[model samples]
Target: MESEQAERFTATLEDKLQSLLTKASTLQPEEMLIRHNGLLYPALLCPEDNLRQFAKFDARPEDMCIASYPKCGFNWVNQLFRDIAAAVRKDDGQRKIILLEFSGADTHQVINSYPSPRVYGTHCHYENLPASVIEKKTKVLVVFRNPKDNAVSYYHFCQKHPLLPNSASWDEFFKEYMAGEVAWGSYFDSALIWEKHIDDEHVMIITYEELKENLIGGVQKIAEFYGFSLSVEQIENIARKGTFQAMSDNSQETHSIFGNFFFRKGVVGDWRNLFTEEQSREMDAKFEECLAGTKLGAKLKYDLYCKT
Candidate 1:
């Protein structure tokens, strides 16, 4: 289902990006990071110019998007969706531009030229999605994880990613995380926005815990939502191949750029080890403030995963 698609971005950095690429390559995250729309981001990627160009993209009727904040099950679910697409379409399920997170407008032009059913992923908030996605009513599969664990994985990821700044400690990172100071903006701010769309026909929302609990069922639901019909046997095979261990073993095949840093533990309870009691309380309070009684809040099952 997956084929190497890295060559598209291999050209030498464009002239306009020279400064950002230089800083992203040579400087620490502290010195290299930039802010866009109140969110801190790696200097080299998620450029405003590219994002502006992306806004003008003409989304196709068949275009479907997979979205999540960083460190949610983005890689896993994106791969799973492709596997399903391959089995259904019986073709190489290739996608251009991993996520529309680049510094050049050429990427958007290349995407416009790609074949139909162009599946793309994004970490941007729902409103920031391409305007055409809304006008065209393109379907989006949005995945969210318990933020406690999300923060832990993302904190470590920043250290490993050369372009982003590093946090001196988990405490420092957690502070920024709660403040919505990291890239992609505040998790809560976006979560609340997504909650309003819980009943939307075009949006299919799932949680990492739900996928972990029932990969086969989750896969089926995803396939059905996208109108991709897969036989029961095919769904099972896809689910088995997508288990955490299978994803970890074959990650190099799918996401070799990050090396081992693309995935760490990926366990639900790992945050228990990193968060202090005060931090846990703070997370609970934050959840209460933003997502307490909403339908999406119930979907996150915060007490079961984040509290207990």
Candidate 2:
């Protein structure tokens, strides 16, 4: 059975990669979309079909989803989810979780096969999500980081990971990021789409900076959102277990899915070390142009949170 499963996964991976390469071949230098099944999707690692299938997914009321732009402290927040699930749903047997865009198998098949209280993680923008996810009141947690930090992290990620296309330099990648040319598309648009639904009873928005500032409090907030009451000590334990150090210590096992070193420095404001003064101003100007006057932009607290 296991061998059959492995064979199926490998075959699916080859089929998807061939399709993507064929689609990518017809693109011009400036064109980034990988055409699949009559749909254009960002040139990301996963097969676009995964996201399309996820859109058609029928979500249950007990489903929990973690949504974020790539490299926005997703793994860290996911650890918290793991800890929370272990604490609150201990008797529910093993938890089945899916990273929607990271797998080779049929994503919809995997998800639908999972038992009740299914947990899913996705980088798909809010606009791409299934209507049932919202209409069914499935719990959704959306997290984000300052675009500058997010770009810096992603630049390094693209450089180090063999899966992604190589970036020539920070400056080159910065331009791409600023122009919203990177994989998974624009971080601004991703956040903005989800932010509009922040007030929905099924959704909660979190920031990496807020979790850094008060992990215990952040865990408490998530606990509350899940309607799971944790003791003070339980919260502290979850906070400690979910720290960057803890995650880093288990990096090899935790990040084996990505097949590379997935955890970098978990500090805020690391962008300061990379961004030149002029570049910083340029980024600020771009942020203002794209995000200013928006409620999502207003709450970003970029300067205050990142610099501190």
Candidate 3:
């Protein structure tokens, strides 16, 4: 009995998992939307409890974090981070990339046990992150995508994620998205919080558009921020393997469960296909309201990707 509790995800993963299965069978979609601290979460993941548990995580100065709003190129950026890390440390290439808030506390425990220069992540709003992340001065990489594309990707993801309420269509999802009724809450609210930290000495903010525009340069830039000094050859090699096509080809091997669900078109401006003139204008107005005049806003280059 004691041994069973000794497992890492005792409360959230092990305990809540059964509840998730049970609830998934019995509960309506709306019933499954758990609210905590003014944010919405899927009951299956029990993110509120997991987040409360993650609050105790003992952050280390050497830890590097990938902090972002969901569907904002996290997987692709994570792939690049892993490629660059493996090229540098030559470890099993598995030490990096774990779900921060979504994974159970037990997983965070395992992370605590790992050695230095650890790579961890969160898709929470900036203010909701563990306070220790700021107190410890842990290096963070913030990734954002244009809101239209981000919303479109997340809407599709909701269909496949068992923990999430699947939207019947993009139109319905867009209304919920604009209202910040989906999991992880509003992107605009998150951008507002993170915009304040863009220039912090320990934080590096980059956008999907920027990385797409300059993959090699972006990889090199992120590597250097994490205190890695890679040769140009190594940067080129990492970029080669980290390309969208290359990663998509290997997604089944790496993300065996979800397979290629995480890899749609991997393109910017895809929202163009789905969004109407009104929707585009709404997203544009929101961006200007939440992020305009900030350094992150400039970094996102709104005129280039999200301009009306």
Candidate 4:
């Protein structure tokens, strides 16, 4: 079982990481900071320097990158792209999906050596992406969720993930999220930055709610984006096989560095259950202030709690 394997690796990983930490040059006893491009990121499971140098990943034009803010259905969209890659490039050898921040291989090496139509997933913002990705016109799929749901999901994710910092309460975490204190920075900032590129030929933006609302249609849109065509039956089969229920049931498919909790409650509008009325209004006001004049925010009409 994938979970059992992760359980077995837990102590080993901790031990190995502890040894590495002692030898690490930049990490401190109480705080480990990875500095890149003038930003300090905690050296959790993924190091900050590695991510900083990711600008040199040397992405190819044919490559596909699934970009998202954390906890905004990233894994879900990553899985969908993986399935699409498998179906579209069936004749080619199976391609490995690279999680840019966590992968061990040098991204440049991985991108250069991998089979055609390589897919890489990242939580990196638009400005931080490798220049080649934009220069070469690499196809990019950006999936965003309602920030209200994003914050709720991220709060729970931090609680579950072993290497992430913990939050004392939802209120505390919500404040951090709004202030852009969490990883990948503010959801509104990331959304606006990526939305600016939506008009580019290489970028396709889809909200998590849209995908959840129509999986088949989402698959079709993505397939078309990648210049691939699937039959009615094939699309139907992928949709049937790739449901949240199916992914949650299959341990290997959803295997995460932390655990399987990453797949928790893959539903839209669940933020309604988590957010207080006051908290919702606070988020709405912040969203309005931050997202003003941005197409993505305007599309949502500055709403943080509404279902689309």
Q: Write the per-residue lDDT of candidate 2 for residues 1-308, one digit (tens) a residue.
A: 43455356555655765666577566554455464433334554555665656566788887768988889988888888877877776642233346765554465665576555566787777776778887788898888888888989989887775446646789998887876767777787787777788788888888888899999999999889988888999899889988888888876555544434688889888888899888888878777777778766766786675443
Error of 2 at 76 (Å): 0.8
> Taking the tens digit of each residue's C-alpha lDDT, what string does model 1 give over 52-159?
666676787677688899898888898888778778767755443357665357666666666666778888778888788888888999999999999998999888
Assess every candidate by TM-score: 0.90, 0.82, 0.89, 0.84
Q: Which parts of model 2 are misplaced by more than 4 Å?
A: 1-44, 91-96, 104-107, 257-260, 306-308
Which candidate leads in lDDT? 3
What is residue 223's positional error in candidate 4, in angstroms? 0.6
- Reference-based lDDT, each prediction: 0.79, 0.73, 0.80, 0.73
Looking at model 2, report the run of 10 residues with the lowest lDDT sum: 89-98
The candidate that wins on TM-score is 1
> Number of clashes in every candidate structure?
1, 0, 2, 0
Q: Model 1 segments beyond 4 Å from truth?
A: 1-23, 94-97
Candidate number with the higher TM-score (2 or 4): 4
Candidate 4, pairs of clashing residues:
none
lDDT of 3 by residue, 181-250 (tens): 9988998888888888777899888999989999999998999998999999999988998889998999
Model 1 residue 190 CA deviation (Å) reads 1.0
For candidate 2, the clash count comes to 0
TM-score of candidate 4 on Cα atoms, chains taken together: 0.84
Angstrom error at residue 256, model 1: 2.5
Candidate 3 clashes between residue pairs 3 or more apart in a chain or in different chains: 8-106, 9-106
Q: What ranking emerges by TM-score with the best candidate at the front?
A: 1, 3, 4, 2
